[model samples]
Target: MKAVIYGTALQWKLDLRSRALLITCYLVPLLFFALMGGIFTSVMPEMKETLIPSMTVMGVSMGAFIGMPTSLVEIYGSDIKKLYRAGGIPLGLSLFAILLSSFLHLMILSVILLVAAPVFFGASLPESLPLFFAALSIFTVVSLSLGAVLGLAARNQSRLTMVSQLFFLPSIMLSGIMFPQNLLPEPLILLGNLFPAAWGYRLMQGFGIRPLLGLGAILAIAVLACVLLWRRQAE
Candidate 1:
């Protein structure tokens, strides 16, 4: 337990120093929130209700899918993995530490949105803050897990950036955050549903059975990520 705590603290500090992590995790997401929140609530007044939830999903998705993977790739695809072995530390613990640190970062960013939305954009709060945060946490895990899979699978930095963008763009653009999913073609809607962002947005809105589906998707992706990471470690 103490080792885990120490690892987590170290990971947090490293992330703080990482320019890419800071940009994707904090700067970009918060900028989008500040800009998009007003555009959304102004253009479609009714959108105020979903503004916080939608943007929260976007921020978390971007950070987890894009930022986290890049960092992980830098760590695992290089000499850092060797360092872990040399230090007699479990690689899995490092992954968990990264995940936990990311969760807290996303939560802090989300809370910023939760508070600022109402004040700046007249966005309404979720009916149940506890349930909303619960859903957000699950969504974060799934998104970060997907990132882990990509990081483990991609062989190099350039490829990692391209792959992460492929996942990140679709997640935000097709996830009903930017527009109505129904407005898209049926195929696109289905495609969007394949990503966790759609389910997370709905789950945040208190839609029926979405929370369960989101939870299942998150856990399934996490298991897949674990398997992939294990395989990479074995090689």
Candidate 2:
């Protein structure tokens, strides 16, 4: 399992170094979260600590749900399927490749936060550092599951990605990372509650350490991931 996680993670890092898949995964999501989100965060100090909710959780989830999965669909689509079979590797490898790539990108942006913590904002990590790490683990599972499911379902790469992005962007907006769920109109708040992002903020905010709907949500997501992955393994 460690090998699976690291192997997948390293390949993704290399791809960023060697490929054109920049910004969308690396720069854009962070920008959307940190910079774009800062436009709102700049006004709300209370919400400022919740930047990861907007940026990586939202941004990273997009990559996980769309980018990783689309790559799977593309790799498994007709011609590449034949080529991969001839090369003697399996479809699972393709899935792992894409997933690892998404996972690595999650870290790249988080690292920026680490570096920027002192330099840009003179901020130190909140006491909820444990929750922050827990949040990263949640990201890994969320992205992994979405990547795998979409990869399994997509007809082709672009088609899969387009569909994924459609879900991805809206998910970010609804995640309540940029805004709070309690403050939204009732309907929007209901919708936001359905996303991991809302839970993520609840977990990351000061409430992260306290028990509440946020803690319950995090546990639920973790259990859900285990169930889904178990199902996938059984298949």
Candidate 3:
């Protein structure tokens, strides 16, 4: 337990220095939130109510789907995996650490958006902060789990970027954040529903149990992918 704690701390410190991590996890998302928050609230005043949730969803998805995988690919596709195996360290430690770190980062970023939105853009807060955060936590986990699958599956950095965008772009463009899902064509809306970002956006709005189900399905698939990848590498 102590070792895990120490290792996670070290991982967090290393992540602080990573320019890519900083850009994706903090810089880009915050910038997007600031820019888009103003635009949405300006064009559609009623959107102020959902601005925080929408931007936070985009930030979390981007960090998890794009940033997390690139870091994981760098580790798993390099000498890091060999060192872990050589040292008898758990193969999943890196994954766990990265997910945890990403969660913390997302939470902080979410809070910033939550606070700043109302002050800067006249955005409204959620009626239930607890429920909002609970949903955010679930969504973050599911997002990172999907990212783990991508990281485990990609063989190279280029492929990782391509695949991450494949998931990230659809989540952003089709998710109700950019525009109403109702405005989208049926096929695109259906495709968006297949990803967590859509469910996550609804979840934040205090929707039904489908988001929980989506989280479970994504987590299961992520775990299965990791297990298979670990076994294959051990061979």
Candidate 4:
């Protein structure tokens, strides 16, 4: 298990070093947080409060569902399945890699937001260690499993990038992270509920406040994604 753990971590670091994924690990989160913070800090105060969590969801979704696959394609390209099978790398190890990468990526972005949010905009987050962690874990697991699916499904780097952006855009905008779902049309609200990020946003909103239906929703998402992933992998 430890070998699997570190092996996955090493792959994540290697992915971060990849030219294709470098910008994502280093620059994308910063730009995202900055963009949302700058645009809504004064006008949409609550939205500013939710920026960190929103950016976090974006990172996890991208890392797991799109970025991991993108990196996998770059590393393995035309022979990914054969490469892994020949080496006896377990599917669990791949999940560990995707999960660790997604979790660590969110942690780094959180730290950056903690610092930048205060200095630039005088925003301070509520403190509640357990709930914060719980919410993050929920987001990480669902997103990471989804990333594994994307890795298995995509054919190339360009397709992976496209898929990841598709994941990022809707998840970010509809999750009520940068904007509230209430402001959107009723049809959009229903669509947002279908996304794991929406549950994550609710979890973050209630982190220091009160527990709601968020955790159960996230767990359901994780299970759903994993079941579908296993079925696909078995083929």
Local distance difference test, per candidate?
Answer: 0.85, 0.59, 0.87, 0.65
Which model is ahead, 1 or 4, in terms of lDDT?
1
lDDT of 3: 0.87
Once superposed on the true structure, which residue ranges of model 3 sit more than 4 Å away at CA? none
lDDT tens digits, residue span 1-235, model 4: 7878688778777767676565665476677667767877778776656666666676666555555567555544466555776788765566567557656765666667666876886675746756776777766666665565566566677887787677667877787776668999998877776667777777765653322354356456656765676666645
Q: In model 2, how many backbone clashes occur?
A: 1
Local accuracy of candidate 3 as per-residue lDDT tens digits, 1-235:
8768877787788888899988998899999988888889999999998998899999999999988888788878778888987997776777788778878887888899899999999888998999999999989988888888888888889999999999999999998999999999999998998788998998998856877887677778777887898677666
For 10-54, candidate 2 gives per-residue lDDT tens digits of 667656674334655666665655565546545765554555444
Order the candidates by lDDT, highest first: 3, 1, 4, 2
The stretch of ten residues in a row with the least summed lDDT in candidate 4 is: 207-216
Q: Indicate which candidate wins on lDDT.
A: 3
Cα RMSD, model 1: 1.4
TM-scores of the models, in the order given: 0.95, 0.74, 0.95, 0.81
The residue-level lDDT of candidate 1 at 115 comes to: 94
Best of the candidates, TM-score: 3
Whichever of 1 and 3 has more lDDT, that candidate is 3
Q: TM-score for candidate 3, please give it.
A: 0.95
The list of candidate 2 runs beyond 4 A from truth reads 1-10, 17-20, 122-124, 206-235
lDDT of 1 by residue, 55-107 (tens): 99999998888888777777788898889888999888887888888888888
Residue pair clashes in candidate 1: none
Off by over 4 Å in 1: none
